[model samples]
Target: MIIATGATGTLNGATVDHLLQRVPAARLGASVRDPARARHLADRGVRVRRGSYEDPVALRRSFADAEQVLLVSSSDIGADVVAQHRTAIDAAAAVGARRILYTSTCGAGFETPYPPLAIHAATEQHLAASGVAWTALRNGFYGDLGQLLGPWQETGTIAKPADGPFSWVDRRDAAEAAAAILAGDAAFDGPVDLVPSSPVTLADFAAAASELSGRHIERVVVDDEDWVAGEMANGTPEGAARFTLSMFQATRGGHFAHADPTLVQLLGREPRSIADQLADQNIG
Candidate 1:
């Protein structure tokens, strides 16, 4: 059977749905922190089991009888994310899983201002040393940028702490691609970057927003310190705000600018671009 962690999350949940279409539901299992939350998947013939990265025994049980395990990277800020990922990897390996696939990001590496990059890099190293075959799906940056970018429709300005030429990808595309990798028999020994051939900067986003909204949207660069302070004032946790800051710093350094056509090759078509997203969303 194939097992997937973080079944309740958007990306992983979408991946599970795609997997169900590609393979038999009996061959799929979802390891979630709370089995109760995954009742829908359980009803669909998936073996929903309680599993947490913090608990190794539960993870082992959840991963039992699995030939491959899709391990979602931990998102616990201020926690030992690397160790948590290692624990999950070790548990999957112990459960006799022949192969492990991790949802890593394209920013993974040592030389980056982004803090999560180090965590992802360390996790990749641990997975490589676990004796089992591993694949790191280096996904592009994916998230809702409207909040950080402010209400351009109302203010006609997109203000952000950092301006990035990020290769933002749709989570649905990435999820489907991941399911394809898990269900197919193609061997990918190491890291594979799931990014598009093109990238869009914040300026490009402003232009698209302007066109879609039929208004002149200006790109405004806010002060770094002031941006963090404002985010905190708006009730965002200090650590979360700082993490966003580091992301901008990393982006300013061109860490997220690197684009590749691996995603297009995986899906046999061009991945949806940020412009398409703007046109479809209500924010634009």
Candidate 2:
């Protein structure tokens, strides 16, 4: 049996949906925190089990009788993310899971300015020592650039610290690649960077916005502190503002500039670019 945690979430849900097409529902299982939310999967014959990262025993029970398990990263912020991942990893190992797949970020590394990247790096280390074969799906930075440039959409001016390029990827593509790996069509051990073929800079985004919306969007470089203050003045929480600034700092440091072709190989086609994503959205 193959089990997927966070099966009700968008990413994992898409992965499970694709898996259902290739594998029988009887062989598929969803380990979600809320079984009631996943009744649709159960109605389709998938075994839905209750599991939460906070409870190791529940995780073990949810993973039982599964040959492969997909551990979708926990969404809890400010919590002990590393400990939560360790708990899930331990439970997966204890349940005799032959292999485990973890959803990680492409920017996950020691030098990343984002705190969650450290947690992901640490979780990867724990997975390495967990004895079960594992694959770290290093998903690229999400293609939700519009959310980050929220103020710019209104002001028609994008202001931020000097930034580098990012190979933003659509979550749908990431989920499909993950499903291929889970379905045994593609084999990957250790970290696999799933990113687009090219990196996109903030200037590139502004240009895309201009073209897609029929309006000129200017890109301006500002001091990091000024940007953080602006975010806070706009009613963003202090902690969230600081984290957003750190992400820009990390971007300026070229932490997210790399591009990997693994996603293309897995999908058997070129993945969508930031421009394509922006064109689809009404960012105007």
Candidate 3:
């Protein structure tokens, strides 16, 4: 069975769809924080299990009858993810899972600026030592820039921390690649950089935004400290601001810019472009 965490989220939903199309419903397991949130998955014939990354007992129960498990990194801020992931991994190991797949940030190889990237890197180290066959989807930035919560892009400028290049991947594409890996039909057993084919700078992205939305969008380059403070001022929790700032700082450091060719090779098609993704999100 393929047990998928974060089944309520965008990436997990797409991953579950791909898995269900290839594997049978009985072979699919979905671990969601809320069973009610997974009604669609149940309707589509996936075995829905209510669980969270924080609860070890729930995780253990969720993986009881699983051959493979996918840990979509929790959306929690700060050290919570590390603890939550540890709980899940320990549970999976105890439940005798054959293999585990972790969704981590791209370039989490000790050089990424995102502090959580360090958490993922450390998790990878622990997974490696756990003696379980594992794979890391080093995912880059999400392509749904226009679908952010709160204000629409038209209300204000698209704010990103960096003026550097970015290789944004469609969440659907990442999920597809992940589905392929989980199927275990090939000899894949290491870190796979699930990035886009082309790396676009912040300026290029702003241009795309303007062209797509028919609005004159601008990119605001803010220092990490200033950005954190601004987020706090804008009613974000202090911890949330710090965490968001860390990711932006990482982007400025080129942590999300590297475009690995293997993504297209594995998908056997050109991954969707940022314009294509933005359009799909109904921005263009």
Candidate 4:
């Protein structure tokens, strides 16, 4: 059986949804923290078991008799992410899983102003050192960039600290690609980058917004402290405003610019573009 952890989350939940289409439900299992929340999946014959990274016994039970385990990266901010991943990896290996798949980020191994990259780097190192085989799905920046991009549609100006390009790829594509791999039991060892066909900078986004809105949107460079002040003045939490500033610094330092055709090759199609998402969200 193929076990997918974090089945209730958007990325992993979508993977389970797609897996139902490609493989027998009986052959799949969902390792969720709350089985009650996954009633829909349980009704569809997918095994929903309660599992928590903090509880290794529960995790082992959820992963029992599994050929592969899709270990979703823990989203517990302000927690020891590496230790949590280590617990899951140890459990999967102890349960005799042939392979362990982890959802990682492209920021791994890059020195960045952002703090999360360190966690990813440490988790990947642990995965590599584990005796069992492992694969890391190095996903691109999947979260909403509204915080980084700001409300350029309304202001017509993209203002921030120096920023660099990002190879954007939709999380949906990443999920489906992962599902395809798991269903076929494809051999993908080590970290595989899942990025878009091209990179996009804030300037590129401004141009796209202009085209979609029929107006000229300008990309403006502002001092880092001034940008933070502006964001805080606009009611952005002080902590969030500062972290967003660090992200801009990381981008400017070329942290998230990794690109590869692996994602396209996996989906056998072009990943969705920024314009497509902006249109779908009705972002004017």
Choose the strongest candidate by TM-score: 2
Clashing pairs in 4: none
How big is the RMSD of model 4? 1.5
Q: What lDDT is reached at residue 9 by model 4?
A: 94
Model 2 bad stretches (over 4 Å) = none
> Cα RMSDs of all predictions?
1.6, 1.4, 2.9, 1.5
TM-score of each: 0.95, 0.96, 0.86, 0.95
Clashes of each: 0, 0, 0, 0
lDDT of each: 0.89, 0.88, 0.79, 0.87
lDDT score, candidate 3 = 0.79
Model 1: per-residue Cα lDDT over 1-284, one tens digit each: 99999999999999999999999999999999999999999999999999999999999999999999999988786678888999999999998999999999997999998888888899999999999999999998887867656777778888888667777888988998899899998988899889878777778888888888778999888999998898899999998888889888988888888888778988889988777877667666
What is the Cα-based lDDT of residue 114 in candidate 4? Answer: 82
Per residue, candidate 4 scores C-alpha lDDT tens digits across 1-284 of 99999998999999999999999999999999889999999999999999999999999999999999999999997778889999999999999999999999887774777877777888889989888888899888877868657788778898877788877777799999899888874699998888887778889878888888889999999998888888789888989878877777777778888789888888999988888877777877
Clashing residue pairs for model 3 = none
**Which model is ahead, 2 or 3, in terms of lDDT?**
2
Q: What TM-score does structure 1 among the candidates reach? A: 0.95
Model 1 clash tally? 0
Clashes of 3: 0
Candidate 1's error at 82, in angstroms? 1.2
